[model samples]
Target: MPAPHLLLVEDEPRMAAFLLAGLEEEGYRVRWVDRGLPALEAVGREPFDAVLLDVRLPDLDGVEVCRRLRLHHPALPILMLTALDAVEDRVRGLRSGADDYLPKPFAFEELLARVEALLRRARTAPALSELTDEPLRLDLTARTCTVGGRPLDLTPREFDLLAYFLARPGQVLSRDEIHRDVWGHDFDRGTNLIDVYVGYVRRKLQEAGCPDRLQTVRGLGYRYVPVSASLHDDTA
Candidate 1:
């Protein structure tokens, strides 16, 4: 197979040079762009396997660029680069359509690993028909959700969380498991990001009139009750 092509959008000349050298050394064909507009133009005119998008760009913020990119290439892998390590920043990047995120001052090896993982996922992602449970439906290929045939608008992270739950219907999933499966990593026990996202998904589900299928397990974690099952009776 040909070497994977990557588009790097970084305004900092030194950082861009460093990444270009590192990625090229790993056998990736790299195209470097310093501004969001040119980056978008480059992608429009060329085929790239993935994009390394800096969160702060010269012409436009990476979040806006990512959002626009998603409108045209929903399945493309976008790895966001940012100096800010705040959880909210990461969440914003993900919601804006980034496939993965790496805070700045990161190890080159770690960046390479993330880029490789994104490429692997993009190439091997499974295709499935709509996953249905009565009034709720999750179309994995289309990346859409609906309840009782009414569309549910969900952020990218919310959609991912729901998809993870639906994939393991009736199984009690610990917060650690959900974190690993959906976010591709583990978080501290004190972190409530998982709960926050679950709340988001739950509210959207309720708004869609899908009932409270996501049940809290008190001491354990949470379980997804399919529409066909009684939410209270299922103990998994």
Candidate 2:
């Protein structure tokens, strides 16, 4: 499949370079515009899956550009980025019809996740009631997990961590990805809470006789490996 294309509007050269490199590494096709007017022009000329708009711009303001863009393309996903942490700034961006907001100094993983989420919502689908990989069944609504019909008693955090891995079976989940999505915040260098939780979940899977094991990738993160081809994933 072709990668999703993105438009980035930021006046700072260093910040733009940082985002472009990181996003491109993740397989996105990105076009960089240093000003807001060019951003509007670019969107009018080409289709993009999403836009990462910075609050302050060289010519036109990002919020005004967002408002105008929304009028022109109502369905397009716009993710506003700003160093301003004020609630008013966020509210103004939302009022301008941005699809989401991310304050500056964000983890690249978090930014990537938000972009993915925007695309996901744009192409909305039926919600999954369960995430299953063979003998391991994670009930989405009931919030229960079972291995071979025997339930494994788990803490709320443990359950969420397992569910996360189950959703993306066989995918290499970065430490930051797990920390941000499962724990609902940025990955803190000062803490090893994610490691601690992952350990707990991994041990439970082992004890429950689950064929899929959460294997740490040493310096990277974890990948859940299905022991057999028949052990497949399904959102039922």
RMSD of each: 9.0, 15.3
Cα lDDT tens digits for candidate 2, 1-236: 78999999999999999999999999999999999889989988898989999999878778888866764455789999999979999998997779899998999999999999999998794546687787888886577889989998899768878877876667888877676456533347578888898888878888888754787887889987765543464521
Model 1, span 1-236: residue lDDT tens: 99999999999999999999989998999999999989989988898999999999877789878876764566779999999999999998997779999998999989999999999998998534467787888786567888888899998878878877886788999987776556542356677999999999998888778787898998889998886677456542
Kindly report which residue pairs in candidate 2 clash with one another. Answer: none
> Which numbered prediction scores highest in TM-score against the true structure?
1
lDDT of each: 0.85, 0.83
Q: Model 2, residue 206: displacement in angstroms?
A: 73
